[model samples]
Target chain A: MLKRTPLHDWHVAHGARMVEFAGWEMPVQYTSVVEEHNAVRTAVGLFDVSHMGEIRVRGRGALPLLQHLVTNDVSRLSPARALYTPMCREDGGTLDDLLIYHLGEDDYLAVVNAANTERDLAWFRAHAEGAGDVDVLDETDRWALFAVQGPRAEEVLQPLVEADLKRLRYYHCIPGTSLAGVSGAIVARTGYTGEDGFECYLPAGAVHEAWEAVWGRVQALNGRLCGLGARDTLRLEAALPLYGHELTETINPLEARLGAFVKLEKGPFIGREALAAAKAEGPRRRLCGLRLLERGIPRAGYAVHRASAGGPDGSWEAEPCGYVTSGTFAPYLHQPIALALVGGGAAPGERMAVDIRGRLVPAEVVPLPFYKRGAAAPGS
Target chain B: MEFPQDLKYTEEHEWVRASRDLAVVGITDYAQSELGDVVYVELPAVGARVKKGASFGVVESVKSVSDLFAPVSGEVVRVNGALADHPEKVNEDPYGEGWMIEIRMDDPSELEDLLSAAEYAARVE
Candidate 1:
């Protein structure tokens, strides 16, 4: 059976194109992808992220239990601060990438990918067995997540939220607040899009009316009601890694270029030893950015080969060097961009070609993040 | 979705206009709206012969790809050059500026196989 978020009916009623994504019937687009993509780049956009899974760890030992599961050091995280971390397997392979929010003294919430919720919970239960006094609960059903993103996101959200949003720095959050008359909402200054935004976590039932209040304000500014299509494009343009694409059971954080979040020296975690060994030995494959020089959209699982000396339809036996993990014709950048897991030798500025089905289209290895928004101006 | 009564539509959601032996082909507004934003369009080269009900081209959006089937047997007289850079025209003005190809149809009678605007609308609805 397919799952539907609390906002599913609202999205359908508003002319959103619904598609099955990650076992959920989610809205892929409300309008055209370009319009929603451009809206986030120039103005503001609202997104229903209620499909994301939220797990609660409530106990005195909540911090230590999390410290043992993820690669990042949980000791550095204080109340109301959220840090992105990659949970790994015993062999240093990635299990999932998620956000850990320190809600208060003895409560923590781990927001994980919707598709991996079941597996992640099993992993958590297996590890938490007699480890501490922590009690793990899958709290996904109790919360609804909404993200207001883009430059004008603060302005669009200011009227509805009672908290001072400006004081909420990037990567920080404020819980136990009221927004649109709903209490216990957690307003976090984090987003997958490369834009200034707020992710609000509220009670599931209250989100329906809260969405109306927030959407009404954004609509007055010509903001968009974005969906999974724009969400994927926006994250791609920012080089944000998707779990199945960038991180898998066989892909480690170091290989995926997520080593900065892994605190190896912060004491032993699940995969610290293997990760440290891998770090010393170097990864066999590295994830890098690719820009198609030819007219081809690189899709996942497309073979990446060394550029051939012959013309478009070359007879040369292409050496499979890598494969694309995620690719799209980025609406914001107006070009085809991709993230590929290539051989360890592949570096930026090198020439490569993507075997887009049968035709090998020339491409260039570029730096991560195809786009980033400009810095905010002085106090305006 | 707006289905112009003057144009002919296919069960596959394409729209066609006939002028003697020549036919102008484009996807209906329903088709383009369903496809979302068209980022790339793959069309058969000019002077190519396309059979009715056969796959003639490909339309790619940000989410998925769909094959463009020929509404009628015809020789491809011209392909839409504007689509190479501005494929979003299929979304912006699917009926007018978004016309994809002009075909010297091999059999004008093949137009009878396509659906009328009202029929196509009912089928989509």
Candidate 2:
């Protein structure tokens, strides 16, 4: 049986198409993918990201335990600040990417991908066995996460949140605040949509009431009730890496272009030696963006080949240089775009061909993100 | 989903409208709703030969790609050129402007193999 979130019934009532994702029955789209995608890009959108897992680490040994577990410097996180980092195995491959929030001294919350919750929790517990005063607790069922994103996100959330939304900076959080009538909610100024937004972490039982309070304001702004489909596309346009697609067990942070988040200078961590060696050796394959020059929708697992020539009539090289990690018809760009991990000196401005099914669709290797809001979109 | 009474349907979720030996084809409303927002549609070129129960084109949505199976063997007389630029027509008007191709049938009696509107609706339900 698939696990259901607190808002599962609400999603069904709102005409959302439900799909089983990562062992949870979640809404893939509330209306249509394009409409929801456009809503987040143009205005504001709300998402029930309750499927995301949360783990709480508390006690005197919390900081030391976290420092050893993740690649980023946990000590750099001040009070009410969130740090994005990738947790890796001893082999330097990504275990899961996490967002650790320092609620207070010795109190932290690490948000992980839904599918990796149990594994991450087990890993944390195993590491904390010898570490003193560290309490690793699985809080996945204790919280319900709601993400309100886009340019008008503040306008919709400001009136409901007691904390000053304007005062919250990026990658910061306000803990123990009343949000949408739910007291003690965590309002974090962080999101996956690459927009100015807040992630409201409410008590699991209070989510229904909180959702009702926020939805009214959301509707006033013509905001949409987005789902996982829109969430995936929004993150893709932002060039954010998804756990399974971009950062797998075999794919390290360096190859995934998330080297900035991995702090090797912070001293010894789980994958420090391997990661440092991998860095010195350089990346085996680098993640890059691809935009189709022809009319074709590139899908995941599609073969990416070097183009012999530049036009639609050009032929593809026999050997595939890479494979698409995530690809879709990017709604905001109104074009088919993809993120691929390629080797053999592929860079921006080089021509490539994506074997979409059997057809060699002409494409070009572009910059990372396919769309950016205020700035000019690359490869447009 | 609207299943036009005048059209015959296939289990693959395609609809065919027969006019003498020429047949107009497109995906049904049910198919469009199931696929979500249509982004691209690849149709066979004009004068292309298609076989019954074989894939004749491709329809891509934001999250998935589906094959448009031929309901009857025929020679394609015309193809929808507008879909190259405006694929949303498949979701907006699956039975009307979204018509994919006009096929000159090799055997008009093949329409007997398709389900009626009521049968199609029952099958989908």
Candidate 3:
């Protein structure tokens, strides 16, 4: 049986195509995937991300426990700031990549991937290491997360929320705010779509009113009731990593191109030593962007190889250099783009090809972010 | 979008408009809508031979990819050139402007195996 969000019935009523994702029956799209994707790029969109897991760690030892678990430096985060980090096993394999929100000196919330909720919680419990001051609570069922993302996110959220939308900086959150007449909501200026947006976390019981209110303004602006499909495209265009595909249990942070988030010198963490050793050795196979220069779209698990014409059956005889982690015809770029784990001397501008189905389609390695925004507003 | 009674369809959702030995082929409206926005399409060459029920092409959206099956066994005589530049035509009008290919039928008897519009509607519904 699939789990249903509070918005499941609403999504179905609005013509959303629902699909089972990560054990939840979530909306994949409404009218179409491309329409929802483009709406987020050019205008605005609302996402019912209620399936994401929320785990709370509060106590005097919260800071120490967080410091020992994640790859990034958690001590640097002041209250209201959010830190993005990779929580890893002792051997440097990623457990999950999550955003840690500092609510107070002793209160912190780690928002994790929905599919990894149980495993991540178990991992946290296993690593508690007799920290009696820290108390970990699974608070996922208590909140509904709605991400109002895109260029006009501020305009759409300002009227509905009590807090000053413009005052919130990127990666900061304001607790004790009221949203759409629902009090005790947490409005955070954070999103995965690489847009100026806000994610609202309110009581699940009061979420329907907020969603309806947000949907009203969104419809007036010709915005979209988006789903996981648009969310994937938006993140792909921005070169953001998804957990299962980009940062997996075997892929270290360095290999996944998350070097910026790893604080190797930050004392002792569960995976710090292994991460440092891997960093010193240099990543052998790196995750990089690939643009299809010829026809055919690259799909996940497709073999990527150095260009060769030796094969007889109209395919490459060369062994695969690597494989694609994620690929799509980017709706924003209007071109086929992919992110691949490439090695064996494959670098940007080096010739390569993705074995799409049975045919060898030419491609070239490129820089990350198939699309880039022009400018960002202050504190937005 | 209406499925015309003049065309025949496959369980895989491709539609064929047969006229003697030559016929035009495209996906049904249900197929295109299910596919979402068409970002890219990969089709067989003009001279390529295709067997019924075999995958002759690929249709890609921003989210996923679906294989395009040949509705009838034939040799491809013409291919849709517009799809290279404007693949969204498939979603815009799967019947009229989005026709994928025209083939010289090698076995007209295979047409009898296709589903009628009513049958196709029932299957889709």
Candidate 4:
């Protein structure tokens, strides 16, 4: 049976075209992806992200257990602070990428991908065997997640929560009561889109009322109701990695260009050996951004080829350099951009080809993010 | 909702305007609204023979890709080339400037199988 969020009926009433995604019925779009994408980039947009899995780890050994299990250091996180990290296997392969929130001295909430909830839980259970004083509990069914993202997200959300939204630093979170009467909720200043935003995790029963209340506030502030389609495009433009595409069981966190999150010097960890070896030997492939030089857009799984550097007769020679993992016609850049796993030598400014519809389309390697941050000027 | 009484529609949301031996094809307003903003269109070349109910083109929106099926068997005589650059025309004027293709009908009697405006609207609802 497919699971439904507390706000499922609300989405239906709002005319959302629902589709089965990650074993749950979710809205793919409300109006248009371009419009919603622009809304989040220019103003503010609300999203129902209740499908994400939230797991709570509690006990005295929670911090040490988490530090040993994930790639990031849990000791660095204070109360109400969050860190984005990838949980990897002993072989340095990413099991799941998630955000770890330090709620208190003995309590931490780990938000993981909905599809990987079971796997992540099993992984955590297996690793927590010898670690006494740690108990991992899946709290997904108990919580409803909502995100308000973009320039004016704070303004739209400030009136709904009692917490001082302006004083909250990025990646910090606090427990508060929703204006709609949802209590004991965690409101975190973090988001997938490269915008100033907050993600609220509220009680399941109060989710519907909170969603309506937040929606009313955002609508009053001229924010929009965005869906998964625009969510994907916006994150792609920001160069954020998605699981099962940019992240995989075979793809290590370091090779995914997320070394900043991997704390190798913190102490001994599960994947530290393999990660250190990889660091010493160097990665065979690197993830980079690709900008389409031609009119066609490159899609995921499309072959990326490097034109021959030296050959006689001036004949064009090609070799499979890599493949595109995530791609889209960037609405913000007004051009097609992609994230490709290419060879070491295929650095930025290099020329490449993406095979689309049996035709080789020219593309150029560019920097990680196709779009850059400017002033936080909200649109009226 | 504003389907012209003179036009005919199919269950697949395709609208057909029969003018004797020629037929102008487009999607219903419901289809355009459901598709949202169109970004690209891949139409068959002129003179290409198309079978009834066969895919003759594809329309890509920001979210999904939808196949455009031929409502009746005919030879493609013309296409709306303006959609290549301005695919939003499909969203702006689905029945007029947004017409997908014009076909020289091989069997004009096939129009009898399509639903009238009222019938089509009721079926969609």
Best by TM-score: 2
**Model 2: lDDT of residue A272:** 94
Clash list (residue pairs), candidate 2: none
> For model 1, what is the error of residue A188's alpha carbon versus the real structure, in angstroms, after optimal superposition?
0.8
Model 3 lDDT per residue over A1-380, tens place: 99888888999999999999999999999987777877887789999999999999999988999999999999999998898999998899999999999988799999999999999898887777597789888999998999999888899989987678788999999877899899978899999897888899989989999999999988888899999998998899898999999889899989989999999888999888888988888887889899999877888899998776665787645567899999998876777888998774356787788998877788988877777764332233
Candidate 1's DockQ: 0.75
Candidate 2 residues lying further than 4 Å off, grouped into runs, are A309-319, A375-380
Score candidate 3 by DockQ.
Answer: 0.78
Candidate 1 lDDT tens digits, B1-125: 79999889998988899989999999988888888888998888999999999988888888777889999998999899999989989889999889998999988999998899999999988
lDDT against true structure, model 1: 0.90
Native-referenced Cα lDDT, model 4:
0.87
Ranking 3 against 4 by TM-score, winner: 3
- Local distance difference test, candidate 3: 0.89
Top lDDT model: 2
Arranged by TM-score, best first = 2, 3, 1, 4
Report lDDT per candidate.
Answer: 0.90, 0.92, 0.89, 0.87
Judging by TM-score, tell me the better candidate of 1 and 2.
2
Candidate 2 docking quality: incorrect, acceptable, medium or high: high
Question: Interface RMSD values for the candidates, listed in order?
Answer: 0.7, 0.5, 1.3, 1.7
lDDT of 1 by residue, A1-380 (tens): 89888999999999998988878889999878888988988899999989899999989888888999999998899999999999999999999999999999989999999999999999998888997789999989899999999999999889888778899999999888888888889999999989999999999988887889999989998899999889999999899899999999999999899989999999989999999999999998899999999786888899998764666675544578989999999887888999999886577888888987578888889987788786332232
